[model samples]
Target: MRQNHHDGTKRWARWEGASLPTNVRPPILADGRHSSGLAGCKGGGHGDPKAAFAKAPTFSPDTDFRARVAAEKFHLCRTTREKGRMGPSKSSNTAPSTLQVHRTSDLRRLLADRPTWGRLACGVPFRDPRWLAPWWDSFSESAEAYALVASDERCVIRGVLPLYRRSNHGYRDLNFVGDGAACSDYVSIACRPQDSTAVAQAMAAYLMDVRDDPDHGWDGVEIDGIAESDETMRSFAQALLVGGAAVHAHSRQSTWLSARRATWEDHLRSMAKTTRRKVRRFGEQIDGAGGLTKRVAETENQVDAFLDELIDLHQRRWRAEGVAGSYHDSRMVTFIHSVAQAFFLSQRLYLPTLWKGDRMVSAELHMIGDDRRLYCYSSGYDIDSSHLQPGRVLLSDTLRELYRRDWTGIDFLRGDEIYKRRMAATPQRIVCLRVFSPSAAGRIRFETWSAGFNAKQWLRRRLGIPPLSVVGMCETGTPSR
Candidate 1:
């Protein structure tokens, strides 16, 4: 018989031919130590308590001791599990590696991970660093970049949430990077489809852990223009809910045109008869009057010229209505120029000008997605050409060109404008989600703001004013008329 102590547990064994028996249990001494069942044992048989166990007849102390101990431990573990005890089982499967969340503020760090970011961005043009970096350079004077990155044990990036932090009414506010005048649509967490939930849960836990930190904590977070079809963002929102966040979501509609038809004629045939006749008539009127021509910006100089014309026309049209257009601000113009150049270099910018003989009728700025869809971001049209419906003619011609190039669709991002419906664009839902941190200050601030917002909405309803537009109102944390 032999005995050993391993890992603070007294293990008893009866060795025979250098192997421990699976069911061996030697005699126990009064001091809670196992003893060799022999008459002259050096350790526990009588006086010396610290003495080692005496050698058995067939046991060699130096022969395969570790192997024997390991085998015994494995046997015990298996036996314990079989007897319905709580212990680790001997199996090949392993637990998943934990995800690590890192906070970064440096633009170069994001740029360094540009390839990974682009892959995880999954073809959304707004999520591209090329677009976001320029937006940050132009408009981030007051805000600080606070991006969250998730990675696995192997240091492979799994997700990235590009956000900017700012102070809002004595509370810290976090918003998506391209949220304001950039008007980015379909913004979401950049991650692979399979890792979305795991990454979200990890990020939510990290947010909870930091919610009370003096410098890094956030009181509120607002994410806008999340596509309703994005399961990843929905999972992320659900994770935040599980973390006890006060999540409020508002839904709005965006219009889209299916441009996958084989030809422009086929596309027009798919529309309603009345709409088809109107679209055809608009195109014919422009072509027959003088001559219709389309100019697409292919050089940097051309891009700058087109942008200038677009800004002038847009401001003139809106000025005629006694309002400043979207491009009135010089900062916005600068941001547009910078981002437009970046997109143009990436071969994603689409600036098309429609002309009627010698007069420019309309101009549009579009960005192409990796999925071969055109995002109709902004447009400017001559109010003088309203009678000829220059905007519609331009859209029709643009679709014709896109179809010839085998593009998939066109997105009339955000807004329920009558023109979108008139052009036979179908409405799709997008959500703006606001999540308040689970901290005391966050709760109070959210409640107070909610009450005031409710009252304002009620007053608007009573006074016959339209409810706040989510697209225009969410950017600045205030309603924009």
Candidate 2:
């Protein structure tokens, strides 16, 4: 349980009583996505995303809420500056007062506060000590991990973002903790809603200031999975540019399903006639064939069995497509297994298996988030059963059940594949950004990565091939544009 730090517990500065422009607004994407890395609405929106897809949704933040958040941060920053701790320029005129960055491990005492802890937990799932503890612990011997922990003037925890530095082919490049493995999609900073911009700017400035003599000097840092539509991503980009750093951004569209309808039939009505008909036909056919059974993992034994089957089936199917599945990496499998225990015990995990009499045909791993979003993390279906359309059938059944349970929405994690569009899932644009130190080594490393990345895009465009995606790892969060 987290406390509400926005309840005016801290004292306000005299500037708050002055005639300063109190016009800061929260950054909510016009497309209805909350730029703060959390969904703005609980479910179904009334705003017509065109008359064709009319659905009620959680509305955007009101002006009052945004004004309050903005005003609070502005006043606080001004107050800090007035004390002569930090000047308007990077050349600090006096010693800094409140803000300090710390390693992830040292944040326990700061996080002891209810409000701060809750904010971080909501930003990133703060459960599973095993998962959180090993966040910076990359299995690769070449990688070293740490998180930049930011605190404010009053010693209140503001934000934390994880980082991992490693020498990639003699080039020291700093990437995010889960970058090498694409398990995390929205790598947002764990900051209070009001302090996101400030914290991000501070982090960027700190990175620039200490690049020459960093704790561990790295050529470049890659911030991956930022939503292109998000203001926070833009803020970081702007901050880096202001500090005279080189930045490159690559973008992709991800899929998400809006589960705001009251019933399965109502949701189906919103889909194209062709898609709806196919789903109906597949459902009947699958049901008729050996009496299809949709079962969710319940007992501990069931969870273990289902996860193993999921990995096996997913691997087999992807192998047939000439790609090793996410489970191909022993480390990834181990990580998922390690986290599965906690998720299972809490019943937040949904491991669904589709069966035809005695044989399993499809398996999917899903995690329900605190914001009521259901993440369609990973799925695997028997390739031999493709003619049965087992994948679609499984997905359809899953959505129906999720709707019945009143889940807000379903995120397809990553990739805007044909099936997702066919299901009427909304497309959100997310980008992978790399920020480089203004050094010779940084330029060299950045160019190499950019060239390779461009070459892949060229090949895909010329060959009309599907975009390369994270093999089997995909996750849910609000930061994606």
Candidate 3:
């Protein structure tokens, strides 16, 4: 049997001798008219059954017609079941709640719907408006709020794509608000899982619609740190591709430690024998060095002091390597301070300083997700206390405590540092998705940027250096214009 789909695709099913379900409509014939005969049977023919069957639509006895028909029905049922699970489909013309785009230039306007936004953020601390608002407060001097929000006909928010527009080298581009020096991971459209595809399609359509508007149009878009497995972002890219936009993607790996063990000892035992030994030795060394203690900033009043110490230590460590650290930028410092305060108020900040008696040995900036997972955002350690191995010792202690407390997991965030691997954190892939509008100007910009990026990659390979990363480039300096 042949069937036509609304999307202009055709599906063919082979039929063996089987009765069709009463509710199953008759198949459409090759002439695009419904056949009055029962499926798999000859119409009104009173001849020999074999002769009549020969003239019917060809069927293979090997094919299970009933099973195929059942499967098709199931697919239709599933699609219908999910159709309004996350509001109406954006592509449907008769959708009861058509998705609408609400563009805002003020972050405060977006925050007015904080409760809904937070729900849509779905427990990713970095994507929370609480985090992005602070980031924008500190970095807004260089960018304009261009957040795209999607709502249903009833004004109920379905998704949010937190972005800011910036002009670079005479071209305007849009980027995620919590990006740049913050180095946010798992960044993507904020929406419920069921609504992701519809939300993404709506957002993509909004972008395409505004591509030519003088005030709202953008030359390109660059979204980094989205997880490689994020179907929402993949759907968004696919939608843009279907709209003739040029999209580029790059993938990188992040490390995560499973922390679901019942006890700290059990967690240690699960690690490789060598790793277990190293963790023990590191703890012993730190203990021998005047015994280590962790001091967490339990209140907002302590946020600034803890953050200042982290910055000082981080800059010192990086300067020793002859490179300015991420905190070296004044804007970045301000951004971090603001983010720390906001996250602290939200009970997601996990700033801790490791001390050896009177000396601060290491500090880590972490964020707690709604799932109780810890995201190790950034860290700083006293290079002067290398013998004590402050970083490793602190990490070991942190993991032990989190495991004992029944935390879901601990992410090492981005980068593939040897220490993270030695600690037995598994790798997860993240990707950067870039799209150029389908306009002439967008095409020119994409070609120019692509050529330069390719040249950089070629040079890095020739020099035996690792591939370039958007995060690395942002940390080192402003992204290539």
lDDT per model vs. reference = 0.64, 0.55, 0.65
Q: Model 3, 264-381: lDDT tens per residue?
A: 7777888889999888776665456558877889988778988898888888887787877887779888887887888898878888788888888898888888989988877888
Worst 10 residues of 3 by lDDT: 472-481
lDDT per residue for candidate 1 within 204-302, as digits (tens), equals 666766677665678999988777666556545544554567665555455455556777887887788888887777666545764777788999999
Which segments of candidate 1 are over 4 A away from where they belong? 1-97, 252-255, 285-289, 464-481
For residues 4-107, write the lDDT of model 2, one tens digit per residue.
00111222212212211111112222112223222222211121111211121222222222232234334333433343222112222321223444343232
Tell me the deviation in Å of residue 406 in model 3.
Answer: 2.0
Best by lDDT: 3
Considering summed lDDT, which 10 consecutive residues are worst modelled in model 1?
1-10
**RMSD values, in order shown:** 22.0, 13.8, 16.4
Best by TM-score: 3
